[model samples]
Target: MTWRLVRYELAMIRRNRHAWWTLLTLAALALLSFANLSLEAARANADKREVAAAERERWLGQGEKDPHSAAHYSIFAFKLSPTLATLDSGIEPFVGQSVWLEAHHQNDMLDRPQQKASLLQRAGLASPAGLILTFAPLVAFLLAFVAVAQDRERGTMRLALGASAHPRTIVRAKTLAIWGGMAALLVLPLAALALMVAAIGGRLDTDILLRVMAWTVLMSAYLALLAGIGIVVSLRAPNARIALVLLFALWIAMALVLPRTASSAVDALRPLPSSQAVRQQMLDEAAAYWTAEDTKRHQAQLLARYGVARLEDIPNARMAELDMVERHSHQVFDRVLGALYGRVADQDRLFSGLGFLSPTVAAQSLSASVAGSDFSHHHHFIVSAERYRRDLVNAMNADGMAHRADSNERHINDVRLWSAIPEFTYPEPTLGGTSGTAIPALVALALWLLAVTFLVDRAARRLMP
Candidate 1:
């Protein structure tokens, strides 16, 4: 009986020209998004390689600079594109891609791609992920909002209920059919993306494939929730139009208004200081502290901990060695900056925590996280870049310390040392790592799915008569 109803529902959807047209439109949009992503990914990869080559040339060109001077003239490292970044772009386009690793302060990533793009990119184009995760679900809502109400208005519900078919079975069949259509709309574009990536010599990870599958399941579940909500509204409302209005209002609240409001509230509650301001303040404080007598005593203590009797007695070479020590002092200042930055990130996490109240937000956040497009993913990139910076600077400083005997020594310049330094490389984090960070959002989605399923069952029983 359920199979019969499912077949009937599928046939009904196929016969609806509007539904077919909407699905076709969605498929077209998804394909376009995939193309855009592939183009952008190719561009980003090319840019990264170019920058890396330029850095290599510049380092090798530094004929015979002292190792300490090389440390002070550290190279910039660009973040590499993740395999799945093309699908979602996420914060990659908005955040800076490259970091300058000079001797002192850890520089923030600079040159946001979004700043170079047209304004429309900021509002969001119909990216494949966005179409599936966002727009297609809305399209499903449009299809389902009048699924039962139209039948009732036309007396089909009464006729069906009078037959041997159970109302619960009827609702389940309807949901399954609509969900099938939604899945196709989503999967077609993703299949195209897979093909495009394969054609471009990109390697796809099994974990990424699994993440995409999970994302698909989440999207389908969200559509099911919307379908269930639509049925309940249709059963309760007097007419199809009212059912749509109610569903639209619900969609607005969940999909549109709440996420932004929560984000705004979180910002107000825990404001983050600008990166520029943070950097400037750290530099000022470091200068003041280094100059102060009490601060000098503290430095003396640090040097003592390192088993050094005096600054000159410390086993190091020239003015360059002194510069390296000054650089280490700046590193201490950066630690203070990192603590403050962590506080702000904690506040952002607190905001993301509210995803429980809105499943749309939860699904969106979880999808992005699993795909490595979330803020945490970007943060990991920045942190990785910083680690590389430290490595590069330390390598150069070690050479400086070995070559020069005292702060007064004019060191021999050896450009060969500069060429030997390793170029920075960025490794994209795994989906498993990012998904672990997204468990809360996934749980929230599960709870909402359960709640909607329960409500659908309850509503079906009530509407049976």
Candidate 2:
């Protein structure tokens, strides 16, 4: 009987021209977004790799020069894109592509994707995960909002009840039909999209396949929750119009407003200091720590320690002072940047805390984490880059000290020495790392779905017998 009811609902939906059109329009839009993303991902990765290779060759081919000069000619550490990011570019647009690893200083990554976008692209840039979370639920709601209430209004509900059919069973069939319809419209198109991406050499490896499947399951759950909400509204409202109005209001609150409000609240509660300001403070500290008087004192100490009368007689004198300055600068950067890292982590945690109030927040968080564009993944890459910079700079400084001599001696090394420095390599984060960061949001979403399902069942039972 339930199967027959479900089939009846499906057959009725097949006759709704407007619903079918809506599905078509949505699928078209999704394909456009994915197409841009697939090409862009391939191009961006290619450009980054190409530029990195050129830079590496440039470094190795830079002819013999002073170690200090070579240190200044720093290489860039390029971050490659993870395949999942093509589906949902989370925080990637906001962050930079590469960090310049140089001697004697730490650098923030530079050249974000957002930096290259025009005013219009910035305004309407679409994310697949974002689009699905925002609009798919609305599509589901539009289909199911009238599922029960319209039957009641038209008096078919009387026939349904008179047939000795349980209201719960009737509601279940309606919900199942609604969910299946939307899944067919949304999920099937996306599955086709995945295949197309693979055909275009998007590397549908095991990891990427796993992420796509996970994203699909998440979308399914979110849509199911929305469908249940719509059905519940339909069961409780006096008529279809009222059910739609209520559902629309809920959708606006959940999809449009809450996510922004939560993020803004986190920023307000734990404001971060400006990066430029922190850099300035580090500069001032370095200046104060290495004043003229301090340099003179250090020079005298080096002279006394070496038992030399004049600066020219002391070997490695300049290198010793550089060594001292480098150590002090490192300490300053570590202290200032460490504080900034802490503030960012705090903000991320606060935003994660608000996931229960807004499933969109949870969904975005999960998508970003899985795609390796979240704060955690980016931070790890940044930390790794900085570590590499430190090692590279320290090696150069050591070479400086080794080649140091009196003022007349000029220190230079063979260009082949550059090849000895290992290329910067950033490891792709593992699935476990993604899961760790996404777990909180995942849990929040599960709780929401469970809560909605419980309410829906209760509402279904309360419908007229």
Candidate 3:
């Protein structure tokens, strides 16, 4: 009987010309979005590799210069997007995509896509993920808000109940029917997305498969939650119009308002200091710590270690001194930057705490984390880049100290030394380390699912003829 009822509901939707039109339009959008994603991801990946290669060539091609001067003219650390990140950029667009690894100054990410995009694109409707997060629920709500209420108004609900189908059975069938329609709507679009990825030579590896599965699960949960909410509201409301108003209100609260408000609340609760102030402090402290007297002491110590009595007696006197300066800068940068990052992390935790009120937050959080585009993902890139910068600087300095003999007519280091430092490589993120954020979000989504189910069950039991 439940299956029969579910099928009957689905048949009604299939017969609705407007519903078919909406589904067709959504499929078109999804196809276009995924195609763009595949093409852009391929293009972006190629551009990053080209830029990195150019930088490497420039570094190797440079003529005679001091190693320390070369260190000051550092390479840029590019934040390359994961192939799947094109599906949902999460916080990537708003944040910096590259940072200069030059001496004496630690840079935040530069070239935020937000800065380059139009005002319209910044309005949140520019991406398909935005469309899904903001509009899919509305589509579900509109379909299901009248499912039970209108049936009750027309007396078919009583007919079904009097025919020995319990309220629970009928309500469950209605919910299933609505979600099934959404699945039908998604079938073609999802298939097209797969074809698009293949067309662009994107691999369907284990990680990509897992990521796609995770996305599917979250999106299904989201739609099911919305469908259930709509049905519950419909079951209890006196009429269809009021039922829609109530469902729309719920959607707005969860999707639009909470996400924006949570971030604002976090910033207000724990404000971080300005980057310029911290940077200036680091520079001043470094200058104070590496003064002329300190340099004399350091150089004397280097000469003593090498068993030489004169300043020029040691082959790498300046090399050792520059290394000392860099070591000092690393300590200062770590302490100062560590404190600020802690504040940013606190803000993130506070926002996660607010996830208890909105499943959309939880879904989006897990979605981005799974895609490796979250704050943590970007943080790992920055830290890795900084480590590379430090190692690269130390390596060149060490080479200079050992090999820069006054008698070597080639007074300047050449390509051999320049190419000796290995290229910087970023490691992939392990999801096992994502427990910090993932656990909280997963729990929140579970709780919301339980809440939605409980409400639906209660409404089912309370239904009247």
Candidate 4:
């Protein structure tokens, strides 16, 4: 009986031209956005490879020079776009894609795409993820807002209530039918895209497939929550007009207003220092701590270690001083940069916590994390780059110490030493490692679904014509 009623509701929905048009329009937008992003990601990855190769060539071909000078002529580490970057560009547009890994400083990533974007692209919704988050809820509400209210207005809901033993059963059937339609609208194109990618020889590895599954599940739940809310509101409203007004108001609050407000509130609460300030702080502290006295003390230790009477008597004194400077500067970078990263994490946590109020926030957070375009993913690349820089500098210093002459001769190294430093490779982010943001987002979505389900059930029990 329930299935029969669901079929009936679905049939009625199928006959509604408006619903079909909305679904088709949204699907078109999603696919177009997906295709555009996929192409952009492909181009970006190709460019990254080409630039990285050129940088390596430049580094290796610079011929024999001092190892210390070679360290300063370091290569730039470019970040490759993840496979799922097409699904959600996330923070990738705002955050730069490459970092210079030279000695004595940890540089921030450069080449932000947002700087080159036009006003229209910046202000409007342009990505697949944005389309889904903003429009999918509207579509769900549009379809389900008139579910019970229109039936009541046309004098058929009373007939529906009398046909079923309990009002909840009829309501449940309608809700399922509406949510099922939304699920189809959401999942079908995604499935088609996956198959298309596979047909084109794109590798959907286990991890990528798992991320896709998780993304689909989360988006489905979010759409279901919206559908259920629409039906519940429709059941409680006096008529279809009132139902739509209420649903549109709710949509505006959730989809448009609350997200921006929450972001502003987070910034107000945990504001981060500017890049200039951070750099100056690092330089100031490093200079204050590594004074001439500290350098003299380090020289004394180096001489004592080498069983020499003076700094000049110590073998490779220049390399020893360079090594000491690099080691001490590491402490300053950790202290200053660590604070900056902590604030970023705090802001992220605060924003995620705001998801309790807006499911859009939770959905977006989860989407970005799964797509590997979130700040956490970018942060991992930066940390890795810094580690690589340290290793490269340390390797240069080690070579200088091993080969420099005692007569204050200029020590030169060839391509052999430059090629010794391994090329930077960004490690892939695992689901477990990125769960910091994803887990919180998942929890928020679950709570929203659970709370909405309870409201839906209560509305079902009190459902009237």
Q: Write the per-residue lDDT of candidate 3 for residues 1-465, one digit (tens) a residue.
A: 889989998877667666556656765676566666666667766787789888888888886687767777778777777655655667777888778876655667888878877664577555556566777777777778557766777888899888888889889999999887776565335634654574466455666666766677777787788788888888888887788688789789888898888778878998988878877777776763466787778877777777888867766666766777778778988998888877777766667767787877777777677777777777788788898888878877777777655533323577787788777677656654543655677788889899999999999999865
Query: What digit string (tens of lDDT, one per residue) describes model 4 on residues 174-239?
Result: 888888887787665774585466346455677777777877887788888988888888888877
Tell me each candidate's TM-score. 0.89, 0.90, 0.90, 0.94
- Whole-model alpha-carbon lDDT for candidate 2: 0.77
| TM match of model 3 to true structure | 0.90
Per the 3 Å backbone cut-off, how many clashing residue pairs does candidate 1 have? 4
lDDT for 184 in candidate 4 is 83
lDDT at position 119, candidate 1: 58
Better of 3 and 4 by lDDT: 4
Which numbered prediction scores highest in lDDT against the true structure?
4
- Using lDDT, rank the candidates from best to worst: 4, 2, 3, 1
Among residues 3 or more apart in sequence or in different chains, the pairs in candidate 1 whose N, CA or C atoms overlap within 3 Å are 64-415, 317-404, 317-405, 317-406
What is candidate 2's CA lDDT for residue 64? 90
> What does each candidate score in C-alpha RMSD?
3.0, 3.1, 3.0, 2.3
**lDDT at 117 for candidate 2?**
73
Q: Please give me the total number of clashing residue pairs in predicted model 4.
A: 0
